[model samples]
Target: MRAAAAEHGLTLDDERDLTPYLDLRRPRDRFIAALVGAGRPLPLRGEYWRMLRGGDALQWCLLNGLLNYRVLYFRPAAG
Candidate 1:
């Protein structure tokens, strides 16, 4: 996996930092993947951002969590 990432110019200095994200890529998260594959929005957990955005899954997930929550429950996803 490290070699694959390195080929793409992605550095994996901390294993823990990316392991969880990789888990999200597996069959266990198949439902979410299927939803996105079908062009449907997820239920505001922001796990999808990790796939869409490159930097720090932790950070994107944090901000997107709240944003998705607000978008789903209170308003549209974007203005």
Candidate 2:
């Protein structure tokens, strides 16, 4: 992930530089803080966290479905 970000000229110095501005006590809090610091509007209450979690779940399901389909339909035949 870090390599990919770096490839796009993006830096991930959260551990040292942005840690002071972030609340590292909780994952959700840190994520929200980073978004706000980057000038992004935050969602009300826990909505941001919920939405992120839901998106992750959906992505996982899609990737799993694709992998299963590939295995079933595109596998190489054994001699």
Task: Please tell me which predicted candidate would have the highest lDDT against the true structure.
Answer: 2
lDDT of each: 0.42, 0.46
Residue 47 of model 1 has an lDDT of 60
Return the TM-score for each candidate structure.
0.21, 0.27
Clashing residue pairs in candidate 2 (N, C-alpha, C atoms within 3 angstroms): none
| 1-79 per-residue lDDT for model 1 (tens digits) | 5566556555544433223333334453455545455543544446655563333343346445532222111222232
RMSD vs true structure, all candidates? 18.7, 17.0
The weakest ten consecutive residues by lDDT in model 1 span 67-76
TM match of model 1 to true structure: 0.21
The count of backbone overlaps in candidate 1 is 0
